[model samples]
Target: MQNREQLWLELPPMSPEAPRRLLVFLHGAGSSPEAFAPVALAWQLKFPGAQAAILQGPEAHPGGAAHDWFDTRAVAADRAERAALAAARLAQRVAVLQQSTGVDAERTVLVGFSQGATVALEMVRNRPGLAAIVVAYAGRLARPIRSGERLDATVHLLHGEFDSLVPVVHAHQALRALHASGTEATLDIVADSGHVIDQQLIILGTTRVMQTVFRGRRRAAGDGRTLH
Candidate 1:
């Protein structure tokens, strides 16, 4: 299995005052929270009062000190079913976390890599508006979304052009799917890269986040203006 790695992680959302932003990060298959904390923290730094969580996958992946959200060896149909159920469970977890952290779905962000990315996308696919944004790295859409479903969050898909494991085509296909569903989304493919996250990818992801956050604020402001 491919091993992956991410920093002081402060989960102090339980403070008397609720945080304004919530970030939930998920590592790839055969990875743990300890391996993805740094990446999660990187995003948190951009959003003040944003509490972050590097969540561990629920199941143990055999032959390693890693965890998986669902079985990867199952047949395609079975794997899809398993992933959907996993996403459902995760959505529930997010709801509870939001209540405790005082972060509403509109202020929440979900970031995941590879299989973790699949689950993150799946959850929002099942719910349509579970969080305000999802930043998927080197991952594809695991389940089919209904046509023209109302997407409450914008999705950003980032992939490595030379990623053999997940292939860049998946990102293209996912973007198409999201577009057909009337969801606000974007895709960025990094050249000369593989399945792993590197400095270039990190910088690219940060740029996407900044653009989306600011654009959302502008739209919200426009909506609040009085019409003549």
Candidate 2:
């Protein structure tokens, strides 16, 4: 087992002893925990009672100084297998995080971007109960869910409308698949957005986290479906 403690930038809660939720963020490919520091800081500031942990990828990027969850280029056959291995490791890390922070699965929110999002989805599928909500941006499902598989989390997929890299269609596909499998999932298509995260998307994600943590507001009145 890997020493997962050395793999994160842990941000403690602002209000000590007040029940805190855990926010675990996984960065995109070729990025480090440092690269995501600003986002983590913003999230902490927005929700001071929430504990944040920005994690680094397990493997070094072949191109240079950054890191990757799994190989993106070449080895088409083993891509899914490799991604699954990475997700399993992340699951272990999440378990450690929950134990250390004293936060339960329902109060934990797992977040990921791009390749990280792929791994987050896989983590939920392979090892459930890490979180009740998953915020995946610019990513897709790692593999097809087998028949009778169950996903207990509420997944929120945010994708840029003009994303050429992964394409918005992937988000749609994930939403459909998750719904078909009886998973609570929603998709938010950002207009005029590209492959990057913007302020609007950040606010949206933060709001969702608040709603989940507080439980004051329901998912609208009439329909159970989220409109966004």
Candidate 3:
């Protein structure tokens, strides 16, 4: 269970009243908000004007003292329903953040790792357009997304080719599911990588967020240039 004293870790934006983007990060099983807070902080440097929130799972991870979004030991059939519930709760949390920070769904991004990614993916089904983009690392769908339940946000699925913990096949399956549902999804396989987030994945995530956040915007005539 989450420690009532510390529910989440947050990196406030440089400008509380105005910010360019927001990132919501979810940690893997047996992990706490602390596990992903560093990366979330580092993103401030990478994205320049973004705030980040590292959310802790509501339930305690069965493996240890860390937290988990859903009980990993639950029957496979029940896992999906549990994940759906988690998604609903998380959407409410995100709404609070959005209201307090003024970062709407259009300017926010959802990023998750492993089991956390599964819950994030579930959120896409539960609340479409909850964010502009979602980046899932070393994760897969806990259950298949049904037809007519299309995800509205752009999704980037990254997995290590040599990831033994989750296996790369899961990424492929997720890609198929998202594509079938007509979501804008991309599957990027990192060669020789393991079930871990590396510099490459971080850069890719940053770039994707920037791209989605700035897509279709017109720059001023005098503007030198932008990465996009």
Candidate 4:
């Protein structure tokens, strides 16, 4: 992991006792750390006593009023390269924080939206055991994943079926890659949503994590499904 520094907002654990879990949040492209704070808080509230952190993208978005994890102007493959760089730095930060909080990688939960979500998935693409679970929304796989590629994180991909910016097809493609890599993953498509975040999606994400990450249960099957 790269040792480059990244900005982070820490929300101390609700309890002073030793926290066993760490939650990390990343915002979408052209979105700020503040804009994603509420989503982080909601997840934290659902998982009591877990420490949480919100990471801000390093550069400002060219469009203004926000930030981006990588340069969007770059071509498809180049964009993935940029996202990989950002993911390396963010992974380093998370590792350092985990040491301080006494939370191991298996107890870490990484969540992100859009661009941030891509980087979140990238974190575990080649590095197994970085995070126990990853919840990515409205994001595509930045890198090509081959069959049997090492990945220990159980990923939950959530997307809007009608998403125009990043078509739901991207999520389906990612799921296929994940499956080929023999990774444990799931995809949920919301029927009545677009590119934007929907409350129902958020609820589904948290619920999914709570069921598998915390409760150690498995869903019936490993196929993608549309949610009404």
- In terms of lDDT, the best-performing candidate is 2
Scanning candidate 4 in windows of ten residues, the lowest lDDT window is 219-228
Clashes of each: 3, 0, 1, 0
lDDT by residue for model 4 over 1-228, one digit each (tens)?
A: 122544678887766554458999989988887888788877777776788988888877896968888889867668877888899887888888889888888689999999889999998875677898999999999878865585789999999989999999999999988888788899999998998777898899989887775344233233343211
For model 1, the superposed segments whose C-alpha errors exceed 4 Å read 1-10, 13-19, 225-228
CA RMSD for every model? Answer: 5.2, 4.8, 4.0, 6.3
Q: Please give the range of 10 consecutive residues that has the lowest summed lDDT in model 1.
A: 1-10
Clashes of 2: 0
Give the total clashing residue pairs for model 3: 1
Tens digits of per-residue lDDT for model 1 on 10-129? Answer: 454433343368888888999888888777766655664678877777778889978898988778778888989989988887787789777788888898899999999988888866
| lDDT (Cα, 0-100) at 135 in candidate 1 | 88
Candidate 4 all-Cα RMSD: 6.3
Residue 77 of candidate 1: its Cα lDDT? 75
Q: What are the Cα lDDT values of the candidates?
A: 0.81, 0.84, 0.82, 0.83
Query: Deviation in angstroms for 37 in model 3?
Result: 1.6
Structural similarity to truth (TM-score) of each candidate: 0.88, 0.89, 0.89, 0.87
Between candidates 3 and 4, the one scoring higher on lDDT is 4
- The segments of candidate 2 whose C-alpha lies over 4 angstroms from its true place after superposition are 1-6, 214-228
